[model samples]
Target: MVGDYQTLKNIIEQSLLTALFQPIYDTEQAQLYGYEALIRGPSNSPLHSPIALFDSAVEHGLLSELELICRQVSIETFAKLGLQGKLFLNVSPMVFLQDDHPKGATLSFLEQYGVAPEKVVIELSERYVVNDPELLAQALLYYRELGFKVAIDDLGSGYAGLKLWSEILPDFVKVDRHFISNIDKDSVKREFVKSILALGANINSKVILEGIETEQEFYQLQELGASLGQGYLLGRPELLPVKILPSVLTTHQRKVKYGNYLDKLASSVFQHAVSFDSQTKTGAIVDYFTQHKHLHSLPIVRDQIPVGMALREEVLELFASPYGRALHEKKPIIDMLSSQPVVVEADTKLDEVAKLVTSVHDEQLLWHFIITEQGRYIGIGSVRDLLKQLTEQQLQQASYANPLTQLPGNVPIYQKIDDLLTKQQAFHFAYFDLNNFKPFNDVYGYAKGDSVIRVLADILQSYCTAEDFIGHIGGDDFIAIFVSDNWQQKADSICQHFDQAIRSYYTQEDLNQGGIVSPSRSGELQKYPILSVAVAVVEPDVERCRSHHDIAELASSAKKEAKKRCKELGKSAVYLCQRRGPDGL
Candidate 1:
């Protein structure tokens, strides 16, 4: 026990708890909105892991001391690094209720360091429990009164997480890593995550999905409305002297090595196959494929089994063949098609599809291939039809996606805005622009600017909704149109999510530079104002005094007001601008 004391003391005094800042990105803006403060122990030490350090501290009856030290270190480190976003620090429930609680002292210490409770999010790790609901609620209320935000950590990691959420009513929920790690591969996980997101929505609690280490998981979570993400994929946990990731051949190479893929076939394809008796007419087969653009051919079956595929080309040939009359007459399509047809199961490897395509190219005639499940016809996939459909789909996607942000572009953006506008609903439009973005791009190479753009896109996509149209209007500009009867409230909610995501995505160096970097424009060090957003509210226009364009113009002007404040003050603050629609009599 004596030895343990000396070791623990040494560990705490030496600041053994090093921090790794995993980027929390906003899906809509694709920006670093905030960070989770992960405590890493000393290298080669028994307390090298955060779990180990905290557990040992708790066991040694030093949970409060350890947590307080972690909080101080995280704040000091963050201040020194010049980070502008929120800091998420883990706190055990036991530590929150320590008998000799130093909550007042802790709050004062943070204020001295210029860290406000509002910027310091206390992640409520369920490592310990509060048996009394009233006690827990009181503790949370105390924190809330101090402007401190509380989060329920490892949500969905244990039994009865939903119960915990209901009881705690936390300001945020950090989803367990298990659900995020393999989200792309498991439908159940995706559905489960979606449900959790929906729940968070109902409570107006922010959902910070943890442990996303792959692009597949990132995309999946973004689509499912995960507001913030933290994991190795966005940025790994590391000590200070945080470096903004560079754009280089090596960076590209690394992503290639660790890249994640969805499915081989695009998820949007629509196709279905049907089977018929061998005695079925050729005309019947033709009608089937003609009706479904995705279905390229029909299978000729015998005894509820696939005998062979009646290639579309075979039917076409019969129309031109000497037996053309038989095509429309009493002749069976099976008699004309090859009795022995190539068959592929639904789970067949992508390589197998390539091989089949190659083998068919050698044949005199070309046609659609049959897809089966356990030797039974399930669908038909034609190389030609696939090429055509995929091409059109890709084109459509390109148009919808913002060229700069790579988010769904202006088309969907306008569509969503129109829906709310037509309903005569009040909504908020948060317009964002990068101050000195062109100069930064001029210095850092267009590639770096592209990275920044992607970051912004990701932030907006993750935080907003299908109903909330997020649009990128080129060059450091983005617009989020959120429909809500209470526009100001919704704007506030979005702003919180946006701010957190931006702070999490960037490294200390990125933040310290004021988003400028060593790279220079015109050989001068590049500098930029603090990255921020401006919001404007456009209420329903019952008097019909303005057009959509006019309302949009008014919102744009309001955004300029926000930008002007950021330029003059150099501080983060929400500036709300409202235009009295025709409704103001």
Candidate 2:
């Protein structure tokens, strides 16, 4: 056998590598999407597989060199071939900050091959242990400034995987193959995928489901809000002659992406036309409005406050209508126009707009809807124009929506949790369980069980106010959100209502017996206690929540404590679990 040193050097140098292109489809469009550049060495070569090659390289102190070669080749070849769409290239964190990186040369090569900086995605692999998080973060920042869109590869693969995400803030997150491989066979894996996907959304990161080899996985990932797909099912990688894959857009997804685009524009609504003081004359308003053709209307503000609106039509109508004849004499534009056309929050849903557009009530005759935050008019978005944008966003959301409850589901729930934690908002999170739901479902048919769940959801909805958030955690599990002050009260109310509504689904005999009278999984008669619930509440630390994996471990621990307490007390109607944090807290 060859000696370790020589063998390692040879493996690194002679890693006969080939490329495999896994398609990353548009989350909303369902098109062939783009491709993630994956590398595989010769079947017999020591450096044949990424795992083997990288492991051996690390052991031999050649990891940096091996990673460098891979980068050079992937960039050089893809840029030369003028590949369309995006190129996802995996880079090790250790190699990302190499002192002598050939970035200048790579950029020059890309220019020569007609590939722009935006077209290339640098996916930092989840392989090496990061010794200095600050160093990694700085490197990522530098690369992003240089026009390289960053990604974290194999997210949720190890202890350090989630940590890297906080440090790097990747543009894309590639879900590990292990989680994607058999999601159809395991509920646990599906939850894991949902959590990871949600984490990605919270960070505003795109997600690419890796190692998806079956149609089932593809559809499942789509349903989980994963817009990009990178796996064998779409198409395997090929050298040279790049063949374009077929479109993957579904009817529903196409509509949704359009909506999201609108929402994005709405976020920057403040950048549009300026609002005129309510005192401004019609002549002054017309001058400002004409200066910017993009402006559909002029907001009427009084004392730095927007309370009314003046539109192009309203101005023209002022000139034509009987009311206009009187204004024609002498009056300010504020006097001629109506009060601010019914304003809506910038974050309002497109569906809400759809309904408002068709409303016949005192719908405030208006040219546009003014979007505001905290009672301040920030931007004005036309209902007609934003409709298209809402369609697109919905498509993407639909891709990740859970089929069971039609709610945003587990993926969205994870995303919301991550967002709340990251924002460092002081809030309480309650993990809800249906207490003996399985036995109830088992005793009654799935249909009746579903009805009970729907009822539970209805009750939760009744209690959820604008500040409150609720999510379905899938299969007898639920989640509730509230600010610090009213969190416990909301949770108590939910439990009280849930206990009542859930019991109503049971038969008189079952309720009287105070236990489940049903066959077990093995068809044996079993009498388990009446259904009960346990909740685990916690205030998360944004910086430490890290990835879905970390947050989940915290939630899981809380849940276990709840379960243990329930068993110990021999009670089940409702129990408050422990609150966990650092030792001092």
lDDT of 2 at 160: 67
lDDT of 2 by residue, 220-289 (tens): 7766777777766666666763333322333233234222322353543334657887666676666565
| Model 1 C-alpha lDDT per residue in residues 1-585, reported as the tens digit of each score | 222656777878777777767667655444466778778767877777787787788778877777777877887788778776788877777765677868686587687788777888877776666665567667777887888888888987655457767987888898889888789999999999999899889998888888878878877776686767777776777665333331221123222221222124422222565677889877777666567655445667887567777666656666676767564646776687764655667665444564666676425334556676677666666666656654565566545654454444566556656666677666666666655566556655788778767765655554454456666766777777766445455555545554555555456787776675544546766456545555544443534634456556666666677767766766433466656453332
Against the true structure, whose lDDT is highest? Answer: 2
Clash number by candidate, in order: 38, 36
Residue 421 lDDT (model 1): 67
Candidate 2, superposed: residue stretches over 4 Å from native = 1-16, 42-44, 96-105, 108-112, 240-585
TM-score of 2: 0.40
List ranges where model 1 is wrong by over 4 Å. Answer: 1-3, 10-17, 40-48, 129-134, 223-225, 241-585
What TM-scores do the predictions have? 0.51, 0.40
